[model samples]
Target: MRTTILLLLAVLPLTLMAQRWHITGFGGLSNYQGDLQEKRITTNQANGAFGLGVQYDLNPKLSLRGGLVYGKLSGDDKKNTDSFLVARNLNFTSPLLEGHILAEYRFFDLDNYRFTPYVFAGLGIFGFEPYTFDTTGQKYYLQPLGTEGQGLSIYPDRKPYKRVQVALPFGAGLKFRLNEMVTLGYEIGWRKTFTDYIDDVSTTYVDPAALLAERGPKAVELSYRGGELKDGNPNYPADGTVRGGSKVKDWYYFQGITVGVRLGSGSGPFSGGGGGKRSRQTDCPRNVF
Candidate 1:
């Protein structure tokens, strides 16, 4: 009986320490939805996304997760088979970095099953720099140009948009416990943003004359890029013409596999002779989730 008690005490600390925290690493494809994306999912245009995160299990059913992710989003009118979109001749790419905090809910008690489905929701902010290449292959950042009459004397109603925007991320995933310390997960998350200018295309075209005077001639050239239309003698859109939809906002997505592992600390949950019931449930359960 004394030997069994000693063995239980030794095992208890290890189990609690293992359950406290986990580190996650993930990588996968990313895509965006906006005026440029006629289709919701464009695999050919998918960009790379990667992230590193940490998780703290609050209970058998819930956890708190925090992470930083980097994703690249891009869109081009040229990729569209739609006749009208092809004539638009505009394209932009934005690389984003985001930090988020989320709550994760497991549908089944993790201790009861090796596999579980889960859902997560979080708030985050991301920074993006939208850029496009000119005919000479020189890259230009679009925000400075105020493409839609922003930051211009002629258009006081239009304000310069922010480079960093807020977003809500929500998603679901399925995870499989590979071992006592490691788990694998497949997740797909959508970032619903508050801003529509992630691609630097929104609202109506600004007057070229005004943009040239305020920003530069290059600004005017990039503000309306239909000049390279496949059909000869392309007619550029006039000022006040629709450049992008104003009513709807842009969105981006991430879908990938995550590998997680628990790395314990000396003063963990099960340290200093914690509750025996909690420690026992870590190894043995009377009922399943």
Candidate 2:
């Protein structure tokens, strides 16, 4: 991390010298798509997200940007309109945090053309912890419980998923120059994540008896919410029953407006950018006539 920071600083002068440095801040709604609510773009569960970034334009059409973003993502079958989903009654909310380095390609130059549409793709590392509340409103973190049989010696096929994972972020946006020193943009980005456990509902249901023995009653309660739905028994699905679609992965989205400031030039010639030729001052005596 230290090396990376030093490298960025070293590159800053080069970026600004070329009249291509920009610092930006973005904030807006974020949403998730997974087993809970497949194919829905509705904002019923939207959460807040914000980010700060720096960009270096390599040319009128291409640039490189690095930034950090944070947001909250949640999914609740109880909050879903689908009757079958609401009956499933499973839910989880997790904080989303990541740092990304992306390459952007623009259709035009906002600096000179006034407006531009662009696309970006990048890699990121994100951390998340999924949790939910019990009937008495007691909150429980689901990871250590081995829900869906994760980390259980008996369930050889199910392995524990990590709290931090890799993400692929790609999307498009439009930018408008607010002035020579500032720019405004709006973008919609999607993150394809490797872990399906972001919501802690992947794989099949585990045996209640075994789950209870290993992780306690709290695990059993969280592993299966439908048991208390309308029936006294939670064993209807039995073990190895489908609790979540493991075949499909999970994804999250970020869309928001950005405000950015151009850096360097106005500060001073010694600050970095090309100084060009220093023209000689005119003779003062001639102006007195």
Candidate 3:
């Protein structure tokens, strides 16, 4: 009984230490796909992104991770070659902040291989507020302006959309073990969002008179920008004119390199202990050698 108690005490700390955890830092470029950007993925306006996270190894092939990432997204109608888009004449930029929890699966064992390709899928919540600068360089946020008649008494169906929304994150990456203490990798992840308003242009246009009366002049000015463009449509569309595609939701993605450091010195069950030495027996020591 005494020996068993002593063994339990001695092994508990080592067992806890053997649980592998990593602190990770990531830096990369982020881009978006929305009404303004017709392409599925483009680097035309990619912006800087970075994140910090913690990960735990569930076994040789699985890991669970959680982290926060911040990035910027921007799009412009003038940059598009499509004449219809050019005539629409809209542009926006927003800062994206996301918090996510993901499960990762690796193709190779970390203990035996120096490199591996991995995939991850998980859930996240993100926040964003789209804004644009007028001809005079005055910046205006678009949501509260109710560009599509959101929050208006006349449009009962066009409810105000929240700035924060949920997203599904999934992607693949390659990882290289720098050493037992450090690791390096590159990952590309896409966030599938539930809302189409990330770019602040969804659904049809509202009546300019009503928008002006309710949200004021700035709202009307920013809500429909085609008139501001040279050779663009001088007249704003009538109420219910299609402003954006509401059927397809917006998507954002991040691609970058990651660096991780192991949290403790104790080796996991399969990793084997240091110095190629056999593990000491767990039974209580008979006496000091």
- My TM-score estimates for the predictions, one after another, are 0.86, 0.84, 0.90
Worst 10 residues of 3 by lDDT: 280-289
Give the residue spans of candidate 2 off by over 4 A.
1-18, 230-236, 266-289
Tell how far residue 107 is off in model 3, in angstroms. Answer: 0.8
| Candidate 3: C-alpha lDDT | 0.86
Q: Give the alpha carbon lDDT tens digit for every residue of 51-156 in model 2.
A: 9989887776788999999999899886777776676788888888989999999986554356788999999999999898999999888898888888777888
Best by lDDT: 3
| Stretches > 4 Å off in candidate 3 | 1-19, 266-269, 274-289
Q: Candidates 1 and 3: which is better by lDDT?
A: 3
Model 2 scores a C-alpha lDDT of 0.80
lDDT of each: 0.82, 0.80, 0.86
lDDT of 2 at 288: 31
What digit string (tens of lDDT, one per residue) describes model 3 on residues 172-238?
A: 9999877666889999999999999999988998898888888898988888888887777779899
Angstrom error at residue 141, model 1: 0.4
Off by over 4 Å in 1: 1-18, 265-289
Q: Which rank order by lDDT, best down to worst?
A: 3, 1, 2
